[model samples]
Target: MHIKEGGITSPRIEPRFEQLESSLKPQIAPADASWKRATLTRQPRFNNVVARNWRGELPLWVSYWVIGFIGNLLIGIIPVAVDGTLSGHGYDPRILLITLAGGWLAIAAVSVWQGVGVWRSADARIIARKDLGRAAPWAILAKLAVFVGLVRLIALAVNIGAPQMTELSRMAFFDDPDISPYALRIMRNGTELEISGGFKFGLNEDLVRLLRAAPKVRIVHLDSTGGRIGEAVTVYNTIQERKLITYVSHQCMSACTVAFVGGQQRWLYSRAQLGFHAPTFPGISAGELADATEEQREIFSAVGIDRSFVDKALSTPNNSIWLPPEDELLRSRVITNVSDGSNFAASGFGANLPRDTLAAQLKKSLAALSDLERVAPDEFNSLVDDFLEGYQKGQTEAHLLAQGRQRFLRIISTNLPLADDPTLIDFGKLMIDQYTFLNQRDPSLCYQYAAKGELDPFLLSPTLREREAALDQRVLQTAAKRPTIPAQILQSLWGKVISAVTLRVGRDNAHMILGTKVSPAQYGSYCEATIAFYQEIIRLREPEAAELMRQVLAPK
Candidate 1:
């Protein structure tokens, strides 16, 4: 090496990679306070490079949606690929190998390019959004997460630690030679989560395990006849913290429904039964019972879930435990989607519709009435108030039909959020519009929304272009991992009363029901009955009916 300063010039030779590392041998900082020191720090993957790189370039909302797409493609690859293979529709091994390798190379390329820019910049040090002291830290952490996500995904594929395919059937006992709480695969949709064990579990059990594991996992695979309350509490805490999807593709039972409450997104299935019964127990001292209730209350409070839901879950056991009907679960945040025999499972939590249909119909119906101006909002209100005035009332049909246009006016004014936009009187309308032409044309959304309609590919597509973001330089320097895909498909068709979105419908008012999964005409009729019933319940302030109604609302 030679130096060239100002006027002096000399010959020079570049140092090789080995020479540089060997000579610099820059020692990492010594252990700080308590333990051994390290050259680099560790962090949650989300807070790493990608998140640190958040900027003014993209809107926050856009970033949220885009991140999900990117995460699905990059992070969800292993499961998607595995699912495809098992489903008998995946690419051949050679091509698949290339596909994964290419993904790595692509991510590397992005990191390299972004790293160069960062290296050349004035504020080069990165850090994650949550732990930002410098840009350098953000870059390092984000890159690491992407890298970790990829590597973890690949390793999962390599570990097919399940029993032989010939080992079990639907009625087979739990006898798989291999077993693991970690799911072998969770599909692109929410239908199934295949653990390393050949013996299948229900939605609640898997969810509880995933939640307890915390930051290590983002999603859960739940399969259960629906087990204990304590486990449900654990699962609920996890879902609420991570804002994950809660599922019930196979069978979601009693205590399982407790954890289901924590889910921000809830999903269910066709032939997918959700059952609940009162909490079963042997005799206990009064003091023990009080202590148990307090314990239960604490669990719910910690998870930010409603204890009233616990009351409802416990209400189902009159003669014996019962699964609350899907309709009943609608009252709480627990379930997002419900379907009949529909095999779509990769959907996180609920197989929510892009839009609501009944709401739209109600809006349109109201509009037609508004045009006629047959009666004003006040007259309709008077009629509704009178109907609700009953501990029991007259034949609603003649009174309702006679009310005519006023009936719609009352429903729209009271139940809908459409302040100025009469056209938007029903939120369900928006959800319904989301249905693709295929879903709309499907004859079964009425038989049950849960059992029919196709899911959009965007929701299920596995593509990881976002992992190659400029800040993921660490990913450029490292490896990849894969995950197990759930056996359930990402696309779904729901049966009547199974489409949970109906619960959020305008239904002429706020109290949603489980009945929208029925046919459209029936949906309207059911909504009428539900609203009427609730109207009375709300108006009369009936505390007496609360306990009984809770049981009736329980899943059967």
Candidate 2:
């Protein structure tokens, strides 16, 4: 119906019901019209734009999640785990950790960059609403991955900042074989157990048994170049458990240091040294080596060594060693105190060995005997055999030394060429008589002569010639006037003879014979007095000494 207007005679205007009705009815478009709309005339769908952008970015997303993050993580963690699991070993590959840390930073940058790109380009809400129905789980996974990546970054920080912590954690998973002990020279003196030699397999058990049998043992003396780490550990445990002191009078190296640190009180004599180096197992992987090295590193650390020092020690190659100065060792807490081992007796064969065994032992132990053996093997062997016989028949070291001296002097006499000349014979006889007389007073003087090479035939031969020529001149002159000569004349003649005999023998030798040091200023007068006394004895005892006197003073 139309509303009435003010103008009369106007046709009744009504609302156009037909146009409204037709507009409301569904209108079908031409097929070509729809095709034209889709292909050429349509505005862009914002949701579809997002889906396309995301599809284009799929490669980077795959790289970030699959290759960069997950791949790198597996590369770092899997080997450590697998090696530790399969071989019961672990190691810190510093180079590998550094490389992985670099990769983590790179991947983290890519992840952030790619995320901002997606945020700026794609409408994630629209994309999910339209097409992500089946991929809803992937969206949740992305959130979880972000959280995991954050956790990994934190761990990487810990690895870089506190490497020792990481190393300790890695070491905890391994259960390595214990180092077995090797045989060594072990000696017991009172309450001390002295161990000397390389530590090898079987030492632990041996030491354990020794300690068991000797519970009163209070000190463990170690002289070693190291050996089995396990054996050292055994000693360390024993020392710690017993609350015993550890002493080093000579040298303790490598694994020996491990045992030494276990002592409640560690001792290193002034001349002694402690050596250290990284632990090694033959044919082990680098990772395993690091694990083994960590064992000692932790041990040293527990004993209050500086971390840097331990690191350097463990980093050193096993083929070489680190012998820290005694002062440095004390500063580093490697030892508790400086000791000279004065309160303790030095290690030696304290057992009462059989005669033959003692002789062999002395032969090997004495430098003088070794020298004699080198110079005269047969004489040395015969002397040693005689020593054995005498010792079996009860002879002391001093007595044996005396007998050896006598035999040595006899050897020099037998080898001398004195029999061809009467003058040479007399000179030789004089030396023998002098030695025999002095030896009756102090047998050690004979040993001193042998030791000092004072009776060396080669050295004495020229001197004897000089003495012989002097004696020949004096004896001829004395023989011309002696038998009926005045007392002063006889005394003067004998003085000249004695001077020739004692001249090359020297005042030092004369004092040595007397076993006292006469002053240099008084040496000449003292020597003359000694010579005069011996001369009178010779003159009174033997007419053979005065045969020249008898033969020449007679008138035919």
Candidate 3:
């Protein structure tokens, strides 16, 4: 409808229509240009499945950023907090199982919804980039998140579905016991309460009840390898409140020390041990572990342990143990005194325990040394006192054994001024052999003999008597067979047997009767001579006849 020319056509047109066309043309051109610009700037419609349900751009964006990220994080944190609270207080197993089930279910539902929303939102962004040819930096990151989310979902499902697999994973990571085999005992006829083994859950409650029952228990003996810190802390509070003295018999390790240091007067047996190391828990963050370690530091510090020593103890790795010597323990004030293990019943080889516990075994091994007290009372007492110190300094039983042997040798040497090392060694060996034989035969015999200060060989089953009885029985049996040797030669061989056997027996008996009065050097010489004499007899006689005599007269 353009007015062609300012000639005949323009003169005939209506003035109003011409005026309207001119005015509308200017507005139309601007509106078309503005529409094109807006189209290019606008975001594309979401292309994934969630777009069908969501129906608008705002819903998709809100679900992706708000519900997917923030909401999921909140959900994840709730369960962890709940679990920590429940576990820390030693809640029932069933309650924990129920919490895990509900928490996982809520997490799973929300996570699936979030994944779908995120998928549609990311698709829209990718589409917008393709249509407009503009950069979409979030597209790559969203794609990576989608893949990772799927992997995490699969892992979560599998882990939650299989309890054994979850437990295995936990064990591999934490390396801790699920349940401790802890024990509690009323020892010393109700005067002592012994807490042994691990410091398991509910052990503190056990302590409270036991203390209530045994009002006479003024001492708490700790012998443990460690367990739950929560249990240990509770037990510590109980001990402190009761004003009970704490003692370690065999070992007080890790969490056990927490309770041990709570004593009104902390003490450890001379040979007892206190082991330390950092605490461990599975699935805890570095920050949480640091906090837990700080708690342990505070616990020891509260009890007046040296700060440097506490640092050393807590810095030790969970897999390893740091056992400080008794002097260090005393210097750090970790113990009030080092005991000789006399006050506690665990020092004795009491009922309902294995023979391998070092304290009990040490007591048993040292019991035989009482025999030496009869001959050298001053030396014996000094020797035992030194051994107690050595034991406190962390010496092994074998080390103590060697130390005792050397001390015994010195004592014998001092008594026999002319005796040499070889002679003293022979005397030592004889004493050891006889004591071992007698102890093995009947432990009561030596114990009673030593207790009564009776050195009468006639009352005891001497080694010589057993050997002679064996020889006589063996000889009588051989004589009954009427061997086909000439009577004169047989009689001669029998006499030699008598002489050799008597020489060995007499030498052994004399040493026992007059220890340090007779020369120890003579016993070994006589034994060697007896063996040589038999060899000579064997060489001169017929092989078969010589074998019979050899069997009867061989040195035991």
Give the top-scoring candidate (lDDT): 3
Q: Report residue 51 deviation for candidate 1 (angstroms).
A: 69
- Better-scoring candidate (TM-score), 1 or 3: 3
Superior by TM-score: candidate 1 or candidate 2: 2
Q: Which one is best on TM-score?
A: 3
* Clashing residue pairs in candidate 3 (N, C-alpha, C atoms within 3 angstroms): none
Candidate 3, residues 394-456, lDDT tens digits: the string is 343345556765675445433432222233233333434444444555544443332232333
TM-score of each: 0.26, 0.37, 0.52
Go through the candidates in order and give each one's C-alpha lDDT: 0.37, 0.53, 0.58
lDDT of 1: 0.37
lDDT of 3: 0.58
lDDT of 2 by residue, 109-185 (tens): 54444343333323342254345233333433444444555565455445442453344233333212232223333
